[model samples]
Target: MNRHGQRIGEPASRWRMQIVPIATVMIASALPLMLPLVASSPVLPPLGLLFFLSWQLLRTEMWPVWIGLPLGLWDDLFSGAPIGTAIALWTAASIAIAYLSQRIYWRGFLHDWAIGALLVAAVQALAVFITFPHAPAGHMLGLVLPQIIISVLLMPLFLRLTGKFDNFRLKRR
Candidate 1:
């Protein structure tokens, strides 16, 4: 073998691979608070959902179905949402993605983006409803529209971020 050659069969640490993606998404749940300052309105996108979608779409088999339970619990703690909100939503999204992946073998960037956008919008809608249950429908949607738009726009970035993190996680060490 050449000096620069790598052992083809050797793999990176399994523990690292398992932890990196999940840990990153859990951390992403706290991203809004990590911003330099708080905004007056709910402007920050739902980042935890974005990261979860990225990992599921970009590397479909990397996570198990039950993975969402713990991940969502972590998100709920940081998100000021009801304790079970993220848990329910994240688990549902996980199951949905897993189901879709099994039936639809063809997935491209645009396909993933469309899926992410829909999921994000749905999650955002639910969040708004839960937060402002008594508010008018139009007002509830207005509160979350910017957030939904930002999350949709950030889909590509999170997808790229997931790709990079996946590479880092699997890099031979």
Candidate 2:
């Protein structure tokens, strides 16, 4: 008890967890830049988007509607995609998730996974559309499909990891 007589090792309240998401999202946005680019298949799971969704779904109260713009701009700078593409998509996804959370009370791993899949697919589709104007539609689909599948399959893992991070953030001495 530093001052308030609270236990030293107790976890923080939900209100204190707000900074975790924004910091985590910012860090995640920069991750792809550190990865070694493969010439054969340029597709990699979108870790930034995955973490953003994970934070939003796991702790809906912490995510503000306007958080997406700066985070998306960060992603656009590093992701090599056109400027404003991620800004629009991330903001839209956040709004959609906010709406869904308001309307639906029941949420499970499967439901979260499905929503993640749809969102990831949408982002990937738009990425292909914006980045590869000259490529054939069939080719774009073939390329993006793998990344989408990988991102979807990894959602649970990302969620678990996000939870762990939250735990770490809230943990006391």
Candidate 3:
């Protein structure tokens, strides 16, 4: 590259794309797990991961199908959801994003992320409604709504930074 004096190119293998989001989700999961011990306020919930999935959906260069299975397994183990449930949900969402992506630019990180948050909230509510009928709907609104709002608010900055980092890394390669 001109500034770095390094050869610039696309990632040689698909594995590189897989690594970044997996690592990111794991770190995000850890924050939620640790926040009760570390702070007064609640930690950022999994909306960011959902938004990250949407970002991957919008990206033409990387298809994240392979990453979804392992990440969903990790989420299932970590979040105490039913086995394969998160995987199924995430895969469905990714598929939906991919389909919708064909129609929209998805270039606006904030707008896309806000839409992702809405999807996350709606999907989570539906999941609970069908699978855990005994659970009160009120609980979902009380807990999930605020988290969705927070996630929507936080997504722009994260997407921007990650986009920049990806560009930088691509340039370096």
Candidate closest to the true structure, highest lDDT:
1
lDDT per prediction?
A: 0.86, 0.84, 0.60
Q: After superposition, how far is residue 117 of candidate 2 from its true place, in Å?
A: 1.1
Off by over 4 Å in 2: 2-16
> Which has the greatest TM-score?
1
Q: Which stretches of candidate 1 lie over 4 Å from their true place?
A: 1-6
lDDT of residue 4 for candidate 3: 62
Model 3, poorest ten-residue lDDT window?
Answer: 39-48
Q: Which candidate model has the greater TM-score, 1 or 3? A: 1
TM-score for all models, in order of appearance: 0.93, 0.87, 0.73
**Which 10 consecutive residues of model 2 have the lowest summed lDDT?**
11-20
User: For all the candidates, what are their Cα RMSDs to the real structure?
Assistant: 1.6, 3.0, 3.7
Would you give me the overall lDDT of model 1? 0.86
- Give the per-residue lDDT of model 2 (tens digit) for 47-154: 899999998888777768877899999999988898988898999889988998998799998888788788888987887888888889999889788888889889
What is the alpha-carbon lDDT for the whole of candidate 3?
0.60
